[model samples]
Target chain A: MEILGYITLTIFVGAMVLMLFRKLNFPVQTVLVVVSLICLVLGAVFRFFSEGWVGVILLPNEMIGGIILHPITALLAGLFLAGALTASGGFDVLKVLINKLQKTPIGLAGTLVILIQLPVIASLPCGRIIAAALLPLLFAFGFEGGMGLLTRSQLIVLIGAFARNAFGSCGPSPIGGVGQIGEGFLGAFFPTASEGMLRAPQAFSLMLGTALTALFLKLITMKLYPEGVSLRDLPEGSVIEKKKAEAKGSFKGYLSLVIFVAALLISIFQPFGKMPVQTILVAGGILMLFMCRVSIRDLMSGIILLPVTAMASGFMAAGALASTGGFEALGNILKGFSSVPFLGVAGMLAIFVQIQTILPLACSRILTAALVPVLYFFGPAKFDLITWPQLAIVMAAYMINATTSCGPSPLGGGGMMAEGTMRADTGYIKGAFTFSSMAIMAPLAAIYMKFLTLSSFSASGVQLGRDVWLIIEFTLVIFVANAIIIKLSSKVLSEDVDKNWLSQLPAFVIPGAMGGAILAFCLYEMAFLRIIQGAIGGIIASLLIALMVPKRLTPAETGE
Target chain B: MDCGTTEWLTFLFLMAFYLSVEIYQVLRRKEGEIISFAGPDIPLGDLLGTRANVRMKDGEVVDAEMSGCTLCLGRFEVGDRVYVCKNRDKYVVSLPLFMKGRRKRSDFCKSSCRREQASIQGL
Candidate 1:
């Protein structure tokens, strides 16, 4: 079984190499499916045959009644939804509208950051997506803002946003596929969701801490180098040929817009109770298909296999490492190392080392199986502080791991960001270090000071559940409000500005929509389905608006 | 004298160093660098126990081979020179060696380390 695991691991590595180096022109979809199957089989074989590998497999019994369910299945569902929303013209309209709004390089950067930050609480690409979607926009704005190939200030914001979203109270941080696997393992190993409500002030402070960190960093960088701009000015890019606004009064055009909006709303609120996310996804997909008359061929062609393949590979590798007692062995080894005054520092170092070698998801999952069990050596008194079974330390790990771009994982956040944004460089390394020091490390120190020392805060037993939900609600509200503001602001601003000014707005508006959409998903988990009826209500609302609006312009008069 | 926490910690740090070295080699190879050796530097043929015969891109056939080096990981054939990076990082040059191939830097660079070692020894 161990041998089989090794073989599967090899195949996974080979597949990545082949794809990356262009050794094979295989469709990414086919590659992922084949790789996933190979990994699953290998894991199953190893679990049954290898005595040391018992920890790798989630027993059938466990899955049937487990808290985590099947991690791969959940991940696939999330990917399918995100992919569908992306492929359909749903996000495109929002992107277009946003581009028409911000009108300045800084505004554009802010808008793009918001868009990339939206999928904070669910299955979205936090770092990679931002890089892919926003980097080019930043490049275009760069010339106008006096920024060049690499703007240190802009990189700081990028890192800040990545760190923020990666740890945004989401069930699983979106650092990469590795994070998903690690989160799943943790959920399975400790299958209890503690319930209770903490004071609203507690929630407020925690959020303020994170947000203030982001805001401060953003402002400092902006002040230091206010001229950083987008690469949209590059002559290398083919200029977008302006298109006329067609079907101004056409019911079909309005209907398409309504459907897109409806899908966005439904994705956020999930109107139907106990309805599979896929069901709503498929319905929205169908609306896109028929409303736009987009063929199934195009849909299939647009499907990407990178996320799925990465997810499966991570699951198998982590599973193999866990079950083989590799993590447990490491934990035993860590136990032999005595305590220093700074347990947090030691923990961080251990985590950093382990991740490069064997740890997954910043050791959030592995720690339970490995580190927590070895807490006896530290003495029972310090156990609670370090074990972090209370979810505080777990949460910290999620934040640190969320950016995943910095570490040694061959499949890491940095790689994902590079791939998504098509701009791969040492900028990410700088971003990681900068953000870690500014956001994660500094705040972590504060948290340690407040909670670990000078108070019995750990024993306060404050119900964090309510606080968490409120933060989720607040974040969602901010996203939606920001999106609407960007839209309205851009429209008003564009009327007074020339072509160049109008072009910058979309960068901010589009990211605002993304952030809004993600916040909506977070809201949905807070029992929002009871208040809304999913995409249908939003579609209906849009349709009614379309009927009432006056149509004054013809398609030809709109543009060239 | 004991394998206590401090000693084990030191050992772990060394282990990390070893791992980093190996990873760096792999990275160099992946990035397309040729492998080279120092001290008892052996040629590719000697490392691999097999000679490489290839026609160069410029339509020239080379018949030279390598022999035993001071250290070797596995088999490496001739017609491969050690590709060096801008920072002078060494890697193994394989097919179309002159035309650029993937880097196959080893985790261990005895020559580089030896230089440091000699500097320390002299000191």
Candidate 2:
């Protein structure tokens, strides 16, 4: 018979990663396939035998299958989107905008920060882009400014850390979805408990607040120690080399963007309602090849990278872990929070969690599911029916949203990006973002708990218990409001020389469209309701976005 | 009488060799002075123990790039002056000279340039 234990063990060895960094050695996509195949085989055995080893290993088949499909589909879709963006020079357009912002020391610093952070908004969780772009700038700066070797290293590391945190915190991003689940779970358990007991909005707020707080602290640190620095200016001889490429007018650029976006949308969502994400992505990739006149060789070169594959694997592994009780094990560990006073718990936990040591790809899924149900089961008293589970679910979802990393967790992509871009050691900045965010979560949780506690049975706030719709709506509103703040800050920063570089970057439609497509596919497959409609809606949204974005100015126009 | 004659001969030969050495240096200095040969190179002296500027003929500037410097690549830029050390292989340039925390600019120039210009000038 199919042995469930065998299935779970296969995933455990392949999918569920330990805190050690060794697993980053393999590409995530390959690992996912290997582990997934093992699970499938065991699942088959369980189906046939219906006893013994196979049954013990196999989890709920539908959930596991759904999880397996999520990242695989998303990756294929993202590959097309990224490829199209690259082919059309859309990525270059964004880069030029950032490069132009480096008119002064402050502007340069700001640009560095923004570049490192931008990917977080789209939920691409690595900093290789940041590292590649910023390292050269720092090198150029060193050449011109005459900075000492020590100072240059310091700048790269510090800027990288800050940028990582900024990206992870961008908007009411879906990357935070897992946390949303956790909040729903936790709020159910602690309604009417004090604002201190709640974890979601409070912890999330704290994460944002603490990141800003660290920035201030960092500024103070730089001020106290004065150092000599120098940088090299580009030789007059080099200017001739840069002017060879003639830019097509802004119209051509915009048209290219439209094409890329259209392609992305069609691939992600079934505008016609029946296509798979992989099929769409492959088609989009092919279309980009034809439009750009790029060879198949060039397309492959752009598509392959360690980070992309790793992300796919990480997602698959996390899903497998969730299916096989890995999440439950983690949740059991966190159950210690129940014994602590709700008010002090979040703040205290934030300081202690050694985030850098734990690879975020492994941690996000386990933590989310583990916390969700527990929070929901223990929730509060309602007016008429006194249904505990429903109350618990609402309360838990809200609180958990704040405290957990889910997608935006500093330990994940954002953290890695910051470390690589800034040229700082990976864990250095992650520590600051994580600890400080944790501090914010503690107070926020308390406030949430307090509101729940004093809320009357007949009050509008109290009705939130049964109103799943309200919970989702309020959470979304809060998330969007925060995202707006982040975007506005980014815009203002573009003009300032000393701000983070990533903030001032113009948006790239192709990649953005690609992200939209993959996200849509993931949601559709998971929701399993009107998947085609979701896909179609996604495509339309991408096209609209492509059409609306303003054409980016070239580097020459910016006097770079 | 024999001892005195031998000592005098030895002294005369030593003086002759020293004179030829001085003459050779004078000719070299004269040749180097021609603009075509690259006009008199100036040694700015070492600004720090390991840093200096040497103004080569035609005003070519070179900075030291050091090994194992905190900067991943050795390059230092201090304002318009870039101090690159080819021998050190690390680039660290500091501006305005004063912030360099060195005792004197001339000291750095001397140690870094290593009296190359002085030798060229026949100093």
Real contacts recovered, all predictions: 0.00, 0.00
Q: Candidate 1 docking category?
A: incorrect
Cα lDDT of all candidates, in order?
Answer: 0.33, 0.33
Write down the C-alpha DockQ for each prediction. 0.01, 0.01
- For TM-score, the strongest prediction is 1
lDDT, residue A9, model 1 = 46
Report the backbone clash tally of model 1.
54
| Candidate 2 residue lDDT tens string, A1-560 | 22354446545544434312233322233445566556555555555565565555555453354343333333334444454555455555554555566565757567655544454333322222233323333333332233322233344343434343333331122222223333333343445332222323333443444444344324322221111111123344543223212223343334445565575456434586644434444455556556666543333333323322333344445555445444444344344432344212221122112121122332333333323333332323211111443343224223332323322232221122221211111222332333233222322332333334324322445654644454344334433443444345434543332343333122212222222222223222244333333233323332332222112111112345
Q: Which predicted model would earn the best lDDT? A: 2
Q: How do all models score by TM-score?
A: 0.43, 0.42
Q: DockQ score for model 1, please?
A: 0.01
